[model samples]
Target: VFRSEPPDDLSSEKDRVRVIVRVRPMNTREVDKGDRPILTCDTETSILVDGPQHSRRFTFDAVFDTNSAQ
Candidate 1:
């Protein structure tokens, strides 16, 4: 999530923006291809990055991988 500090004129806590992601599970055909997912995510820390050829890191609010169920 993102946080935005309020102006001094207003008395309030930091404003936040919540982010959520849902990754669909790979189907049978995709499994047969043996293709690998390019990105990996850490739900707890909201971090996503390329599995190979590390170039950059992306931070998120939350992430849901294929194994997760609604």
Candidate 2:
């Protein structure tokens, strides 16, 4: 949250306020080795920016969950 007020020296009577919020998925990395030789998986999210007084959200689901063969 951000708030701003016009300088006192200013003759105009105005004030400004801004708010921003963002949500994203955490990152995950996994490595495994098997008959395939080697395997690796990684997941990440990019940063998002919204206009003033805006909200953003992101969600993702895992297709498969397994233990590392290493």
Candidate 3:
């Protein structure tokens, strides 16, 4: 009952899984207690920089900073 043949290349086009993150801004309570930004983001490379933990790099497909509205 098929009108057209299935895709010839059934294999997945991408071999890697992309990551995305949304960084929420600190609440009033956190600010009162001296809470700080632990993660810094790179929009160009979609990387997250964690300040609390040791130096490290996290790759992602997208990143939404606290100031992002869309």
Query: Which candidate leads the pack in lDDT?
Result: 3
Clashes in model 3: which pairs? Answer: none
TM-score, prediction 1: 0.53
The Cα local distance difference test for each model comes to 0.59, 0.29, 0.63
Writing each residue's lDDT as its tens digit, candidate 3 over 1-70 gives 4212234655564865555578788889999999787777766445445655564566555778888775
Model 3 spans with C-alpha error above 4 angstroms: 1-11, 14-18, 51-53
Provide the TM-score for each candidate, comma-separated: 0.53, 0.19, 0.60
Best by TM-score: 3
Off by over 4 Å in 1: 1-16
Clashes by residue pair, model 2: none
Clashes of 3: 0
Compose the digit string of candidate 2's lDDT tens values, residues 1-70: 3222223564433553322223322334322322221212233322223435863432222212224221
Global local distance difference test of model 1: 0.59
